[model samples]
Target chain A: MPLLDLRGVTKDYKLGKTVVHALRGLDLRIEKGEIVAIMGPSGSGKSTLMHILGCLDVPTSGEASIEESQISSLSEKQLVELRGHKIGFVFQTFNLMQTLSAQQNVELPMIFQGMKKKERAQRATELLTMVGLADRVNHRPNELSGGERQRVAIARALANDPEILFADEPTGNLDSESGGTILELLKRLSTEYGKTVIIVTHDPDAAAIAERIIHLHDGRVVEEVKNA
Target chain B: MLKDFFMLAARSITHRRMRSWLTVIGVFIGITAVVALISVGLGLNKTVEQQVAGVFGVDTFVLVPKGSFGPQRHAGGSSDQYALDLEFLKSIPGVKVAAAVRQRTGFVQGPTKADGTSTQGFLPVMGLSTELVNEFESFTGKLTVQPGGRLFLPEDKDVAVLGADTAERLEAKVGDTLLIAGDANKELNLTVVGIMAPNDEEASTGSSGGFSAGMQPAQSKDTIYVPYDTMSLLWGEASDVLVTLVRTQPGADVDEVADRVEKELNARGSEVSSITYSDISDAIGTMTTTVSAFLAGIAGIALLVGAVGVMNTMFTSVLERTKEIGVMKAVGARNSHILTIFLIESGLMGFVGGVVGTLAGLGLSALASMFIGRFFGVQMAVVASPALILITLAGSFLLGAFAGLWPAWRASKLPVVDALRYE
Candidate 1:
């Protein structure tokens, strides 16, 4: 069975008196240890799809399963547990807590997962070291460079040893050199560590690193590219 | 979870240190006033009780004439100004010593010697039996003659004791002769045999009330102490004389004795008014308690104002921590957890305020007691006790908790999404 499955998924929103359909009867499947790139222009429902995949937003209709457990029907608390224990997200803005050190930020997910402080710190250090941010453990977000901040975000995404890592335009806020480094890191996550990595990006260069790419236009998948 | 709540609380306080201090101060002032007022009131209550016990002595049934509510306005009222008769005193059973006292005014000459500096001062003359001396001594110990001789004995009917001021004014000593006169111009020669000290300078100068050996402005300077029989003989049965002082055995209830005395006196052909020590003490007690409560209630107004200040500070704190509240909620903090944290923070502020206010009140009361007592000649002591302090602290914390309720509820109800999006 696929790690993440979606069948006939539909998401609708009410903006005042007007109705906007964010997702319209979408069907998709992603297996374990697979690196997939979702490419779409702005307002193509790609962000909404990412939100559903990451368990941050619920679908209005349809079934989504993560690890064969029905994700769409889970309670909010259950969803939080699923998010904390099974999924990690990397936002484009590097949404790190400003008041917390980089190390504390990385350990946040494990803390939510109810790990002991010592164990959480141990895991956080290893992940930070993996992302080449070991020396910046104590630095707050304000003290870090853009690339370093994204790296910290990447380390945080792996804090609880999640089965899937979701990166939403992870290099969108970085310079070309920093962006290249982040793409390399994501590629390494899928190729070397065997994490189910999903990247949503508009940049063709960023998408090139993925083994499979799905192109979306106007809230629907238009084509698929395989780079075997 | 508790740890997280504690850390959140600590951070909340640190981030808004000034508002926290302001809230604390508000609660502190309220607690201090409540405690200080209660303590001082208790002290005054204790003092008055002690004074009444001392003044009334063991068991005494005093007969005072009742005042009239009539049109006439007089010091003793228009109650048929009659004194206790000597016949009734000699008749009553279980009655030990019945001394009839006759009050009159006279003057003393300030040492008219061979050099001649004749200064005349007025004094009050209390003419009574030798037995009545015991009653006078018990009421005001200064009523005793300190030196140069003794009080009037039954045999020494023509001898008198001089108050210190009376003696100083007249420059008279033992064996000195002074002429004693009455309201009816009845005059007699008396020898000054003893001198007594005044209760205090203020009491001596007639500036305050309470018993004093010195002559008051209303009394005679040429004060005389003669035997009751001598006065009876000098001015026969026509002059009214029924007021008598009666002393009971120790531990006897003075109220019962006074009631019995009143019945006996009324049965013997004369109206009676019995003045028990309990009457005066009760009056003073009621008056003191009323005044203390009134002043305390007024002080409570200031405390209410302080509570308002605390409420305002708490509201500001809630507003400033909106973003933080959002973050906590997003991290899975329940609504009750958020409420408890705010309550604890507010209560802690109130508790600290209460402690500081209590200390401030104690210091102020002590300073006032020391300085004001010396200047005003009234004894004022601030009595701070542990029970009172604890009550004040608890009361302040309650006030703080009450103040935080609305703010805390508002904070906890804020939507997590909106709060996270807050600036």
Candidate 2:
């Protein structure tokens, strides 16, 4: 069975007097340990699709499921639990809490999961080390380099040991060298760590690291290709 | 879990140090006003009550004619024809002792000026019954004579005990003879027996200024005391009883005895009012409550403004941290978690204000006590009861939480995606 499946997924948003369609009857599937890059323009519903799959949002009128549990059938509480334990997100701005140290930011998700302090602290250190930020554990976001901040965000994303990792425009805010390093880390996470990595980006270099690339336009997928 | 939430709240508060303290000032001002004003008012009331209690003994009751002034009712009458029935007063079950007081203004000539000099103008000369010759000191509890002098003895005639200030004015010493020129130009000599010491309680009560200041009808420090029969010898059966004094047995409830005495006195077909120790204290208490209520009105208004300030601050916080809220939601924080965190933050602001305000209030009350003591010569025992402090702290916290409820709910209800995208 596919690790994640979507069928006829649609979402609509209302702004003032007009109804805006963000997604339209999109069908897709993702298997375990696969690195897939979803390439799309600004209005191509990339965010809406990523939100549904990450459990941050639910589909408007279709079935979106992880394994056997349908996203539409889950309660608000269950949806939050699913999001918390099953998926992790890395944003373009590297949303590491500005007030927290790198290690503390990584421990945040585990804190909400009610993990013990000493245990989560040890794991946060290990996650930071895995993201190649072992020496910058105590540095705050303002003190860290752009690359280091993105690594901290990735460390935080993996804090709860989630099954799927979503990187939204992960390289958009980084210089080429730092961007190359982040894409390399994503490839390594999928290859060695067995995480099903999903990259939502308009960057060709970000798509180059993925095993499959899906193209989207105007709220629907248009083309698919395998990376060389 | 709650600790973690509190830590999170503390982080947010510390992040915006200036705004948080500005919000806290709004609350602490009101708490400070309430705490200081109420404490000072209560302290003044307590201080005056203590002074008045020391001035007048609680175990004794003084009964006077309703319309009498300065304990002098008439110019001439025997005990039997007097306004009050001394025998019936002495017959009361709780009445351990009774004394009939007679007082009037009279002229007396000192030893050097006797034959040709007219005399000093009329001053208050009070006479006490034989029962008071020794028992008056014990019954009154606060009155005492100088160390070298003695009270007038029952068997002794034509002797006087000069009040503290009156002795200074008269330049009369113990063993000095004063010739009294009576109603019909009759001459009498009285030896100075005892010179009364200054009443410290009366001195304090007399000098202080407050609403209840001078509430205790202060006895003149210039009065002269003599035996009841000697008064008749001086006045020739003309002086009438002005005030009646009754001392109740120790361990008897003074209020109960006072009520009984009041009942008996009222039954005499007169409109006289009998005062008890509780009456004086209650008068002070009423004044304190009135002052406190007026202050509480100001505090109520201040706290209302403080509440609005807290609500406003919380709403602004929700707006300012919109993205932070989104990040927290994305990280697995439920809406209840967000709500609780914001509530705790606001509640903590109020609680801190209460703490600081209580300290400030205590400091202000200390200054007020010093001012009253120095300027008014009134000793004030300022007290901030632990109960008041605790209640104030708890009340401020609850008020903060109540004020923050709507804002926290609004924060928690914000759409996670939009909040993440908020600038």
Candidate 3:
């Protein structure tokens, strides 16, 4: 069974009197250990799709399932549980809490999972070390570089040992040099960790690092390209 | 989970240091007002109790003509019309001794002669039987005499005893001769046989410049004492007893005695009422409680205003952290977690305010008591129990939590997608 499966998913938002179709009849499947990119221009519903897959939102109609559990059928409380344990999300802004240290940011998801303090601290240190930030564990977001911030966010995403990881425009706020390093780190996550990684980006260079690229236009998949 | 939330809230409050401090100050002002005002009021109640205990002995009751207990009515009456049946009062089982007292206001010429003119002032003149004078001395446990003077004898007609304050004001020693102008312009020259000790009890009950309409000034420090025969000589045959003092036997119920006296007076068709010392004490207690509650209520308004300030600050905090709330939600925080975090933050603000305010209030009460003691000559004791402090702290904390409920709920209910998109 695929790690993530979606069949005829649709999302609609009401903008005053008019209905805005953010997604329409979207179908996708992602298996374990696969790196895929959903590439689209602005307003093509890339973020809406990421939100639905991450369990931050539910589709208006149709089916979305993670492993054997139907996402659309889960209650809000169950969704929160699934999101905390089964999935991880990294945003374009690197959303590290400014007041927390890199180590604390990484330990946040584990804290929600009711992990003991000593164990979560140990896990956070290991994760930050894996992200090449061993020396910067105690540094807050403001004290870190753009790439370091994103790395802290990625470490936080991996805190619960999630089965799948989602990155939404992960390199949008970084320089080209730091952006290259981030893409390389994401590729290593899929290859060495055997985790299903999904990246939603409009930049072709960021999409090139993924093994599969699904092109979306007007909220629909128009092309599929297989890279090495 | 609660610990984590507390840590998060603490971090948030510390991040915005200035706003948090200002909010705390607002609550501090309110709590301080409540603590200080109520404590001072309680102190005043204690002072009044002490004064009443001193002036009217615990076992002594007063019998006055009906409606004459009121100071305004007492001033309007002809003393000749109000007379207590001393023999009948003494006939009661619990009545140990009964003494009829005649009180009148008169002008006494002082020993000081300014340009050959004697200084005179209005002073209270009390006419008492020698037996009653001895009872008063025994009740007070102190002899009413100056350093080198003696109390007047029952048959002494031309000798007088002056209160310490009156002696000081009149510049009259124990051997000096003073002139007194009594009712109907009757004049008498009497030798001062003794000078009484200064009465601190009178200062507490005397006119201190507030609303004292229905209350009459008790026998104060500025008074002179004479035998009943001497008073009769000055006022002629119309001198009637003004009030009667009844002493209850040791260990007897004063309330029962007072009730029996009232019943007997009513049975004999006498328009007189008897009041026990406990009755006066009870009235004073009720009045003090009411005044304290009223003052506390006014202070509570300030606390309510402080609560509003806390709510406003929490609402602004929620608005500013919209994006952060979205991030937390996306990272798997439940609505309850968000609610707990914000509530903890606001509640901590209130708890801290309570602690600081209680301390500040105690300090302010001490300062006020010092001022009162210096100016009014009455020592006030401020009361602050640990239980009261704990209640105030808990109450302030609950107030903050209540104030933050709506804002925290709003933050928790915000749509994740829209919140992330907020600037």
Candidate 4:
């Protein structure tokens, strides 16, 4: 079985008196260790798809499966547990807690998993060191540069050693040089660590780094391309 | 997990120090008012008990005219008409000694000195039987002649004793001649055989009503005492005994004696009521409880205001940390985790407020007691028992948690998608 599977998945939201369709009849499969990008325009349902695939939301109809388990039938608490153990999310805004140090932020995911303090601390330090922020472990988000904050967020996402890492416009806020470094780090995460990676973005340059690109338009997949 | 939530809560509260402090101050003021008012009320209650005990002595009861205990009623009749049957009162089962006291306000002239001038003052003149004078001496050690003076003997018909303040005011000492005049314009001459000590004066004065009257006895600092026979001789058969104080055996039940006295007096066609020290002490206890409860209720309003203030602050905190909450949810924190964090934060605010408020209240009570002692001549001590502090602190914490419930629920129930979208 593929790492993630979706069949005829549909999502709808109520905007006051109107029903807005965010996703309609979507079918997709992502294998383990694949670097895939979901590229679409602003209203093309890329974010809605990411939310469902990450277990942060449920589809209105049809089924979504992570590993071999069906996600659509899961309760809120079960979904939270699944998300904590199986998926890691990196946001475009680098949403790190301002009051927490880099090491503490990285340890948050494992903390929720009830990891032992000494072990989580050791893992947090190693993860920060792997993200090239070993010297900045004690620095809070406010004290770090934008790129460094994003690095800390990336380190945090990998804390639980999730099966799949999801990045929603991960480098959207950084300059091109910093954004290039982030994309390289994400690419290496798939190539070197054998972790499945999903990136959602409108930037072609970001999509170019993915091994597979799926283009979405008006809540439907329009094209699929495999990069050399 | 709880520890993590506690740490998160602490960090959040510390992140917004100014707002947290303001919220705590609101609660602190409420708790302070409650603590200070209750402490003072308890202190006053205790002081009244001590004063009453000191004035009335132990195992003692009083019998007063029936309607006299209500208020000073001026019925259109002579004061001499309301007299108790001394024979019946002295015959009560537990009566060790029943003393008949005739109280009157009269003018007494001090001795003419070498310069031929005398000072005069209107004072409460109590006429006691010679036997009762001895009872007073036994009940309260040595009522007359503190050091250099003489006690009133059965043969001493026209001698008088002066209260300490009255003696000082009249410039009269032991053996000084005093000219006493009754309200009926009858006059007599007597020598001051003794000057009573200041503390003894408070116990010797006659309290007109029983304990239920709740009246502080007339200040004995300015008064004179003469034998009841002398008062009756000068005023003729018109003199009446206003009140009779009956003492029970040391181990006898005072309340039972009082009830029997009332029953016997009523059967004899005498209109009178009786009260014991227990009655007055109970009344004082109830009065203090009511006052404390009333003041605490007012302070409770302030506490409710403080709770509302905490709710408002928590709501604002949840709003301010919306994005942070989203980030937490995204990082695998459950709704329960978010709820726990916020609840702990508000509870900490209340707990801190309780501690500081208790301290502030205790300090204020101390200061109030100092002023009360200086101005009222009564020492009032704050009852800052550990049990009280523990209850206050725990109460404050629970109050905070209760106040934070709605806001914390709202925070926990927020959708991760919407929270992330919030700016």
Best by TM-score: 2
Whole-model lDDT, model 1: 0.71
Report, for every candidate in turn, its global Cα lDDT versus the true structure.
Answer: 0.71, 0.80, 0.82, 0.83
Candidate 2, residue B366: Cα displacement in angstroms equals 1.4
Which 10 residues in a row give candidate 4 chain B its minimum summed lDDT? B208-217
lDDT for residue A87 in candidate 4, whole number 0-100: 90
lDDT of 2 by residue, A1-228 (tens): 899999888999898999888888888899999999999889899988888898888889989999899999998899879778988999999887887899999998888888898999999999999989899999999999998999999988898888999999999999999999999999999999999999999999999999999988877888888877
Per-residue C-alpha lDDT of model 1 across residues B1-423, encoded as one tens digit per residue: 455445546556656788778777777777777666766776677666666666565566556554421122365433533455666655555555666566545554444577865666555566666776755544333345655577777687766777666777677878887766554666566788787644555344433343332223223344555567656544544134435567765565667767777777667654666667777677777888898899789888878887787677768877877766654544444567668778767766777788898898777667767775799666765677788778888888787777778888888777654565467
Error of 3 at A40 (Å): 1.2
Query: Clashing pairs in model 4?
Result: none
Between candidates 1 and 2, the lDDT winner: 2
Ranking by DockQ: 4, 3, 2, 1
Task: Rate residue B368 of model 2 by lDDT.
Answer: 95
Better of 1 and 3 by lDDT: 3
iRMSD values, candidates in order = 4.0, 1.0, 1.0, 1.0
Q: Write the per-residue lDDT of candidate 2 for residues B277-381, one digit (tens) a residue.
A: 686678778878898889878877888888899999999999988988888888888899899999999998888888998899888998999998899767798
Per-candidate interface DockQ score: 0.12, 0.53, 0.58, 0.59
Could you tell me every candidate's TM-score relative to the true structure?
A: 0.64, 0.81, 0.77, 0.78
